[model samples]
Each structure stands twice: as structure tokens, then as C-alpha cells.
Target: MKRVVFNQKGGVGKTSITCNLAAISAARGLRTLVVDLDVQGNTTHYLVGEIDADAFPAEAQGAAGLFKQTVGSRKMHQNPDSFVWETPWENLFLLPSSPVLTQLERELESRYKIYKLRDALQKLDAEYDRVYIDTPPNFNFYSKSALIAADTVLVPFDCDSFARQSLYSLMDNIAELQEDHNPDLAVEGIVINQFNSQARLPGELVAELEAEGYPVCATYLSASVKMRESHHEHRPLVDLAPSHKLTQQFLALYDELESGRA
Candidate 1:
């Protein structure tokens, strides 16, 4: 399955959900590939740490490279697997992001290379048991490409009024894109992240969303300081603290997501 974790609003745990969910899949012995399309490269750093400048791949090596090569080329010269970098975790791999992605955006859009990402990922599908894409916080070329490329979309939503408003706009965008670009793409559900059960507003907002017919995941991820530590240490909760409450929540969230697939 190819799933993309996306949200137009930032700080809603896009990278956290993408990396941790993909990490959990890897831990289950599934050969998973993470495609980081965010220009910030937060997902890349979270999974692979700092990139060695001297050893970084050339212009056609990472996700940026893959997109750049599609500019005028009629055929893909480099195999999708060639750009994959193995993460520290077993069964997990990465198509690291690059700052150059920002530079390539306008040019890629002008050339109508939106379909290239979908094509490249199709080639990779046979090699990977599961593929997860992390997109930037907007409906840009990269994010659009990810949406079109993915078989399913998992939207990360932080329980707040502002996020709720953004979620409406985001849903509209996804609906339009599904009609115009990927007819088969599915909105898996809205992943409620950083939920605070102690806060009345959070519960009220979630109830409101559900009342409006949004597919909210049953498993709500609680807000925790351990998440910050996991980010600082560059380890997913599944591997960093298997016995922690937050870790169990992540595992349960993974199970919830998998059950949906069934």
C-alpha cells in the first residue's frame, strides 16, 4: 500500500505520523519505503539524521533528483530503487529530501511533471511492501504529486478550531484532486494527533468533526513530552520506548490503520 500523510497546516504531526507509522510497518517486517517530499526535510532528518554534505547524492540522487530528471527526459534513466537510502531501522528505506526541491518546484509545475512522481512510484511498488510519503504543508507541486501518487491519504489533524477550518479547505482540495487527477485515491481518515483528553475543547471539536461526517480515526494520539524527545533523538516511539504509554498508543494507532485496510 502507498500512503501519504499530508496536511496543509503545519505542526499537525505530519512527519511524526509518517515516520512513526512507517517505522511500525518496518518493525512488523514489511519492506517499507519512505518518500520525503517536504522541502524542510524534517522527515528525512528524523529518519536518517544529518546528511553528509560531501557524500550527498548528486543532482539526480534523491527525491529532488528524481523530479529534476523528469524535466525533459522521455524515459526514467535511474531506477527508483537506486535513489533509496537505507534507514537505521531494519526493513525501512528512504528517498531523502533535498533543499533543491524548492528550486525545482516552479520549473516542475511549468513543465507539467506532476504525473512523473506517480509513474516513478509505480515502478517502486513492486520492490516495496509498503510506501509512505511525507508532503509539505501546502497544496504545492510536491504535495499534489504525492496526493496523485498515493493509493490512500492519511491526514494528520491537530484538534483545534484553526486546524478544523484548515481541514475543510484541505478536504475540498483533496476532493478536487481526486476528481481531476487520481480517481482511485482514497482519503483513509483524519488522524487525530496531539489530542488532549483533559481539554474539553479537543473533545468538543472532534465530536463536531464527527458530527459533520468526517472519518476520524478511533485511536487518538495523546499529547506527550516523549514525542519531543523522540524527535530530538531521531528515533520513533516504537523503537525508542516500546513500553511507554505513548509507544503503546502509536502501536494501537498502527493497528487501527491496518484494520482499516482490511
Candidate 2:
């Protein structure tokens, strides 16, 4: 599965979802690769421990390549795996990212290179069993590329009124992508994150989303100290606290996604 965990809205747990899903998928013995397309490099940070800024046409081995339109298809396809890093987990790998991707976007946007990533991934999708893309906070070239390359998409939404509006807008964008670029890409479901059921507002918002017919993912990731600490330690929540309540929730969610697939 080529899955993109995306949302235009920031602070909605996109990286957390991407990382956890990748880790779980890899742990299941499926060769999983995470493509960090976010300029924030949070995914890259958590996975690779650091981002290398200086790999030119060559991506610093499993490091995220800045979308290079001029790089031949042969070359572009070779780089993602070249930058693929070995993680603490057995089967998980990462294509790390850096701040340079921000500038790469500006350069490509002018050339109308909207589907650069999709074009690149097509040449190499056969190599990995699962590909998870961690997109940037806003809808930009990377976001478009993720949507285009995805076989499945997931949106991690927060519990807030403004995020609700952004969620609708994101769905509209996905619809457009489905119509024009990727017809087969399925939107798996919505993962509600940073949720505090004890709080009235978060619970209320989850209710609203469910009532509105949103496919709320079975797992609700809570705002937990361990979740935050795991990122700083450069590991997954499951690795950091396998028995943690939130970690168990994510594990169960992973099982559902794995089994529920048609």
C-alpha cells in the first residue's frame, strides 16, 4: 500500500500517524518505507535522528530527495532507496527530509511540476511492500505529490472548529485528486489525534465528526506525555511504551487496518 498521511492543517498528528503506521507495518514483516516530504522534517527527525542538508543529485542515502525535475527518471528512482536508512526496528526504513525541501517546492511550483513525486514513485513502487508519505502542513507541491502517489490516504484531524473547516476543504482536494490524478487511491479513514476524552470539547467534536458520517478510525490517540517523549527520543510510541494505553490503541488500530483491507 502506498499510503499518505496528510492534512493541510498543522498540529493534527500527521507525522505521528505516518511514523506509527510505518513502524507497525514494518514490524508485521512487510517491508515499509516512510517518505518524509514535510519541510518541517519532523518525520525525518524522529526516524533518522537527524537530517543531512548536503546530498546533491545524490540523496544522503534514504534521505528525502528534493523533488528534482531535471534528474533523470532512472536517477530519481535510485535515490529513494539509496537514502533508505536502517531504523532500530527490523523492517522499517526511512527516506529522510530536510529544510531544503521548502526551497525545492518554490523552484518546482514555477515549472508546474505538480506531480513530481508521483512520477518518481511510479518507477520504484515495486520495491517496497508499503510506502507511507508524511506530507507538509499546507497544500503545496509535496502534498499534491503525496495524494497523487498514494494507493490509500489518511487524514489526521484535530478537535477544533477551524480544523473542521480545513477537513472539508481537504476532502474537496482529495476529490479533485481522485477525479484528475489518482482514481484508485482510497481514503482509508480519519484518525482523530491529541484527543482528551476527559475534555468536553474534544469529545463533543468527535461526536460531531462521527454524526457527520466521517469514518472515525477505531483508535483515538490521546494527548499523552509518552507520545510527546517518544518523538524526542527518536522512536515510536509503541517502541517507547508498548504497554501504554495510547500505544495499545495505535497497535489495535494497526491491526484493524491490516485485517480490514479488501
Candidate 3:
């Protein structure tokens, strides 16, 4: 299953959801590949603490070198093994991104680019049980490419009025992509992140979203200091503190996501 965790709004925990889900899938021994479509490289930086390095795992390095092909390079369309590499985690790989990925629009403007990413990914020899795509916060080419390639999408929300409304925008974009580009895509569910149960607003928004036909995940990521610390320290929260509240919440969400795939 190829799953993309996306929101057109920043600060909605898209990276947090992407990395944690990839980490959990690796823990389960699935050869999981995460494509860092976000040019910010937050997912790449969060996993490895940096993006530019000579000595990356095979999968990680492979992922980074992928977009370097000029979209029409003679080297383009090489086997996934040629560009896909390993990260620090077992069974988890990344297509790492650099500042250069931000130039994809300028780079791929001329090549017969109909569903380019989908075509490229379909050529890969790898058999990942799951592929998670981390998309930038917009309905641009990068994100639309991911949406077209993905079998399912997990929309991440921050539990706010505007944030929830952003889901409408995202849904509309998804509708457009499915009609014009990919017809097999489906929305898996909505993931509510960075919640504060003590606040009345989160509770209210959850109900409102559910009423609007979104299957809300039972697990909600908490607004925790440990999660912030994990980002600073560059470790999964489960590795940092398995007993922490946020860690357990992520684990629950992971379980829900995995079960959905099953």
C-alpha cells in the first residue's frame, strides 16, 4: 500500500505522522519506502538529522539521487535499486531530498510529463509492504504527483476551525486529481494530531469532522513536550520514551493505520 500523509496547511503534524508511521512499519519488518516529496526535507532531516551526506544508507541515498535525473535524462527511469537506498532503520528506505528538489518545477517543465512520478515508481523492482509519501503543504505539482501515485491518502489535521476547513480544500483537490489523473485513489481516514483533550475545542472539532463523513482515527497525537524534545534530539519518541503519552498515542495511530492496510 502506498500511503501519503498530507495537508495543504503547515504546522499540522504532517511530517510527524509520516516519519512515525514509517518507523512503525519498519519496526514490523516491512520493507517500507518513504518518499520525501516535501522540498523542505523535514521528513528526511527528522529521520537522519540532515539531508546532504556522502555516506547514506543504500535506500536513503537512492531516494535522494532519484530526482537528480533531468526528467528526461538518459539515466532517468533506471531501476529503483539504482536510486533507492536504505536509511538507519531496518527495512525502511527513503528517497532523500535536497534543496535541489525545489527546482523540480523548473526542471521537469518540458518532458512529456504525464503522471511522471507514478510511471517512475511503477518501474521500481522493490516490493515494499507500504510506501509513505511526505508531501509539501500545497496543491502543487509535487503534492498532486504524490496524490496521483498513492493508493490511499491520510489527511492530517491540527484540530482547529481553519485547519479542519483546510480538509475541504484538500478533498476538493483530491477529487480533481482522481478525475483528471488517478482514478483509483481513496481517502483512508483523517488523523487528528497535536490534540489537547483538556480543551473543549478539540473535542468539538472531532465530532464535527466525524459528522462530515471522515472516519476519525481513534488515536489522537497529544501536544507533548517529549515530542518536541524527540525532534530536537533526532530520535523516535518510542525510542526516547516508550512509556510516554505521546509515544503511546502514535503507536495507537500506527496500529490503526496498519490495520487499515491489512
Deviating ranges (above 4 Å) for candidate 3: 52-64, 73-77, 109-114
Taking the tens digit of each residue's C-alpha lDDT, what string does model 2 give over 1-262? Answer: 7889999998889999899878888888988888988878898788767543454343333333536533445644444455566777888887777665665666677877777677666766787888899998888888888898888888898888898888888999999989998899888888888888888988888889889988888787787888789999999988788789888888887877777641
Tens-digit lDDT track for model 1 on 101-214?
Answer: 988999999999999999999998789999999999999999999999999999998998999899989999999999999999998988899899988999999999899999
Task: Arrange candidates by lDDT, descending.
Answer: 1, 2, 3
TM-score for each candidate, following the candidate numbering: 0.97, 0.89, 0.90
Q: Evaluate residue 146 in candidate 1 and report its C-alpha lDDT on the 0 to 100 scale.
A: 96
Q: Tell me how far candidate 3 lies from the true structure as C-alpha RMSD in angstroms.
A: 2.9
lDDT of each: 0.90, 0.79, 0.77
TM-score-based ranking: 1, 3, 2
Better of 1 and 3 by TM-score: 1
Any residue pairs clashing in model 3, and if so which?
58-85, 58-86, 59-85, 59-86, 60-85, 60-86, 62-83, 63-95, 63-96, 64-96
